[model samples]
Target: MEATFEAFVRARGPALLRYAHLLCGDAGRAEDLVQDALVKVYRRWGPDIAAPSAYTRRAITNEYLSWRRRLTNREVPTQLPEPATRSHTDAIAERDAVWRVLAGLPRRQRVVIVLRYYEALPDREIADLLGLAEGSVRSLAARAFATLRAHPELRDAASVDRASRAEPSP
Candidate 1:
């Protein structure tokens, strides 16, 4: 059990953080969320969990949604920082486009896309973790990708070239 817990932490901790960060868009909050999820996971780790990472990810996702569901008197910013600043390669423009489209999507769609692309999980696993139907996962990803493909901002190849040219040689 000790070895199992340690191995689980070492292997899945980073992945959990990635999912958390994508959902919360705040590093500190993401860490807290993942920690909270890990505690919940610890309490349930006795037996019959065939997929520990999936179980933990569901916990994290549920926590984020629960926190968001709280009716707050305060306003929250919904925008994510540009994924463009993340890269200097020609890929940066396309990647940034993705973020832009991702930002415009509904929260559920955004979460679905992040889990599918970032974790590289299949639809069935995503469904199991998210408590969503497999068909919902497939449609959500498809619609999100279609929206991205149709977004005009992403099609400006010149902008990609511009970003590429702006990079200094390593």
Candidate 2:
């Protein structure tokens, strides 16, 4: 079944924000990027965009690129830097750790990881969104995953996951 515009946004909004946050490395900027992309998509909604999710993903990527370009040309920063929020929850800590590692990745690699893992998009779609060959998308994802795997946060997470999956000894 197809999702209505409102339903689509309601269902996918948080995921989109996560993707955007990973791309931009800031929550407020990520919200703005997703909003800008949604406005563009909301304007162009029609039969031509059969897959609204894909359309929105592409819009988000394009908006991020355009915004980054424009930002590079700016002389002064418009907003004051915000401090990172502190939280005591383990889930929150784990998420923050993942975000910290992801923030260190190159833009292309970060986008690839977000789209491939977070959005569950295939290589062909990711390639098309980023205007790269499919092989390039796979290679980028491979490199990104390698980097992620080497990070202590991810390595520890993997170890915990493995331990949880192991059978208890008698």
Which lDDT tens digits does candidate 1 get at residues 70-101? 73732343444444353575566556555665
Using all chains and alpha carbons, the TM-scores for the candidates as numbered come to 0.71, 0.67
Clashing pairs in 2: none
User: For model 1, how big is the CA root-mean-square deviation?
Assistant: 7.3
Model 1, stretches more than 4 Å misplaced?
71-90, 150-152, 157-170
Q: Tell me the lDDT of model 1 at 24.
A: 69
- What TM-score would you give candidate 2 relative to the actual structure? 0.67
Q: Per-residue lDDT for 38 in model 2?
A: 94
The clash numbers for all candidates, in the given order, read 0, 0
lDDT of 2 by residue, 1-170 (tens): 23578888999899888778767866788899999999989888777898888789889988877887677543222222344455645555555666676666767887877777667677777888899998898788667667766787664576334422333231
